[model samples]
Target chain A: MKNTDKSAATARPAPGSCSPGPFSNAKGPDHRGQAFTRPGSGQCMKRNSILDAAARTFCRDGFTGTSIDLIAAEAGVSRQTIYNHYRDKEMLFGAVVDEIIGRMNAVLYGILATFPEKPDNLEADLVLFATRLGKNCMCNQDGEFLRKLIQAEGERYPELFAIWRENGPARVWSAIAARLARLAHCGALDIDDPDLAARQFMALINTDLQFCGMLGEKPTEKQIEDGARNGVRTFLRAFASRGNPSTKADPAVKPNMALF
Target chain B: MKNTDKSAATARPAPGSCSPGPFSNAKGPDHRGQAFTRPGSGQCMKRNSILDAAARTFCRDGFTGTSIDLIAAEAGVSRQTIYNHYRDKEMLFGAVVDEIIGRMNAVLYGILATFPEKPDNLEADLVLFATRLGKNCMCNQDGEFLRKLIQAEGERYPELFAIWRENGPARVWSAIAARLARLAHCGALDIDDPDLAARQFMALINTDLQFCGMLGEKPTEKQIEDGARNGVRTFLRAFASRGNPSTKADPAVKPNMALF
Candidate 1:
């Protein structure tokens, strides 16, 4: 079987094995001298390791300078194994990008799930939410790697990055916008455009962090927390509904309310 | 005289020239069998062309992949000429970065000068200001080239990029903050921290434009204009002083003034 296609079949026991019991698929030798266990686990492990090593190398050396042999060496795999999984360097690079994007999207959706659906205190909840988004999404390894790769090679591989543009920022913005729309619908925010507000919210959170992030400096937890608090405060200042009496009194003092 | 050092001296006319008049420094043969003209004009032209060529090559091929011979060839100069102008490839890279940063700073300061110091209409003035900022500073060739270089090579040369951090975003933020503080002092804005406000202001402007800019897509003038108007409206909504009655009535309608 081709190495790439072996991972497609569901995990199944060897044919004519022990009555299809729960332990039948357990990882051990079966009757027919084959291991009855997860299908393609070894191949998948090798693929993931190669992707991880490729990401590190690509981020450090950039695309034009990187070589498949270098990637194979870094990945501790043979050259034949790499070619077995990936057709070429370009395909390998695309796979690395796709893997990072997929991983980051999962983290992002996790952060988005924590958006304050029923915010008891809008500013405080937002600070927590923004903090999570910054730490877990923007400042994480995957995010930094993908950002650097795109900035470095986006011009060279416009089509590859267009996929990123669609799946990364476009989807992230839509999800955030939906949350803001719900908040506006609930009379918490007087937003004219949730789409713009979502973008502005991220912009505010990233303002102080942009230079540090660009230089690949990992921000302290305190820095992330302060940025989030400050960003959410500005956002609330601009969009808090006039009818929201709690925020109407004095907006500046609201964000400092023992949240950190 | 070394070609590089010849540009270091201030522009001056040849000594013992005819009457030392304005035309004495004009481009023509003078005393001492040498051309008497703007002292640094030729050197400056050569230096600019070298930097321009270096920037293009470094951005395309990256630092490691680029060579002095390649840059010299692209710039239509000899390898010895490059060595004469810059000590080595690293020095040439630094010069290219410095030139782009210097050019961008001039454009940025020019944009900062147009801040709504005395806004007859705050939203309209801000829209115009923001449009200028995006079109001139962020979207320009110098800005794009510098940004890509930094993202790609910032980690490779921390000290070099540290200089950029100090002069680039740091100086830009301070300049913008000074303007915002002045506006706040004049009761135009209700900003407690002009620094954060300045950062947030940029963030808002970059909200919609980030993806396109990162992907190396040049935004249309209309796109820039709309982004500015929308970004400024959100900024003003957050920071406009309570006493600014014009903005207080209906924030949505305030920004649509016929400034464009």
Candidate 2:
């Protein structure tokens, strides 16, 4: 599976920045078994640097516009080394996409772990959870790049898209929904279809940020916060249990916008 | 302006299918004045035929991956004819982008006019409106292509993205918000920020449909309807006036999913 490599990160790889666990020629998840593992930490770091630079160049210039030379210059490495690591730009892009998808997957679960099973402050907790998902997962530089590349190259490369199909947003939505189901069991929210509720929750959060994402601009921390805060509020208005659905609650009163 | 060319289509251009209106070599809105217009309806159709084929090919292949020879074969025109209209692949790609963006714009306004100004059946009216918006504007072939191109080319083509900045979803959100405001004015709904409500409305409806979009799959009509119906329901749950916020209504009880 494409996600098989995420386990190699010995460090609790930070949510948004999942380091390339082990470099591989695994173009698609279907052939992941054939991927040869890299040796040595020095080589691992070097591979990560190349992947990072490739991600940046690809996001900026597009798959066609990007070059091994461009990535090599950005990574401060020789083009031959890049070729030695990844056979071509397509292989490199597949690897880059795999890395980001893994990072975003980590980001999703990391935030999900903090979901409020029991909550005294439902709005605050939900907003915080949504904000972390937005900032660390959706609005981050890698998130921006992943989205850009996905929109740009959806038709041409299915193998490159293996990460999403195998370990993608569908899983993220269901994961979040499972948590919402747990919350619903606790009588914290009124939800009939946890799956639909989960999708809507994400949709609400993404509403405001979609424009910046479309234009390939990174939203300010403020914009991400506002989107999450407002989106979560809308989510609550629809799903919160009776007596808790305070539609008129002041948005400014919630001062806690911290990591969950 | 990129939107300025959309006006040339005097045939009451249908939403989500704006024709080239008039072909011009306008690479970006900045140099629109330099664009030489194609002469005569015959040539206009030929140019549009080439654009249509190019759009398909570009979506199928990335900008660099696509060749003039491939587009000529698809359009059934000589390669020289393709060059006769657009100077290069970049110019051709820009024209294709312009056509789709224009179509999406038409789609947006066409659906916006259907918004429930004053509704006797608010739920039915809003759901129908949202469904049409989803089906006609968002999930159609052109809409899918527009999103893919936007996400794919956000960084490399700022001038090519002039349609969005000059006339884009920002307006769509505000325009939808204005309709919601009118509904609120009539006490058919309860909305505080029309802009936020409009955005959330869009976000909610898109929740279910985002998956197909990500994978570049064209959602079935049923999928589009389900998304819009469920999304509008969630929207109503949050914003429907206190007397009208019926979250438990049967999903199948409503039979009408028609145009506004």
Q: What is the Cα-based lDDT of residue A235 in candidate 1?
A: 85
DockQ of each: 0.44, 0.46
Q: Give one digit per residue, the lDDT tens place, for model 2 in A53-124.
A: 777778777888788887776665677767666655776777777777776777677777887666578787
What's the TM-score of chain A alone for every prediction? Answer: 0.75, 0.76
By summed lDDT, the worst window of 10 consecutive residues in model 1 chain A runs over: A15-24
| Candidate 1 per-residue C-alpha lDDT over A61-165 given as tens digits, one digit per residue, 9 for 90 to 100 | 898778888777666667777777666778778767766666677677788888888746877888899989888878776777878888888777888777667
Clashing pairs in 1: none
Model 1, first chain, TM-score of 0.75
Candidate 2 residue-wise lDDT, B1-260, digit = tens: 53234433322223224344432232322312222243454655666656766777676666776788877766656787676666667777877787778767876888888888765777778778888988777876677667766666645687887667567777777788778898889887888777778878988888767866665566788877777788878888888887754434645312222210
In the range B1-260, model 1's lDDT, one tens digit per residue, is 55666433422213212221121123322212123222555654445555666777898778976888776666656677677766668877876676666557667777777887784687788788889988877776677777777788877788766766667777767788888898889888889878778878988887667856654567777777778877888888889986685364433322222221
Task: Look at candidate 2 and tell me the lDDT of residue A88.
Answer: 57
Candidate 1, residue B190: lDDT: 87
- Give the TM-score (vs. native) of candidate 1: 0.76
C-alpha lDDT of residue A225 in model 2? 84
Best candidate (score: TM-score): 2
After the best TM-score superposition of candidate 2, give how far the Cα of residue B193 lies from its true spot, in angstroms: 0.8
What is chain B's TM-score across the candidates, in the order shown? 0.72, 0.77
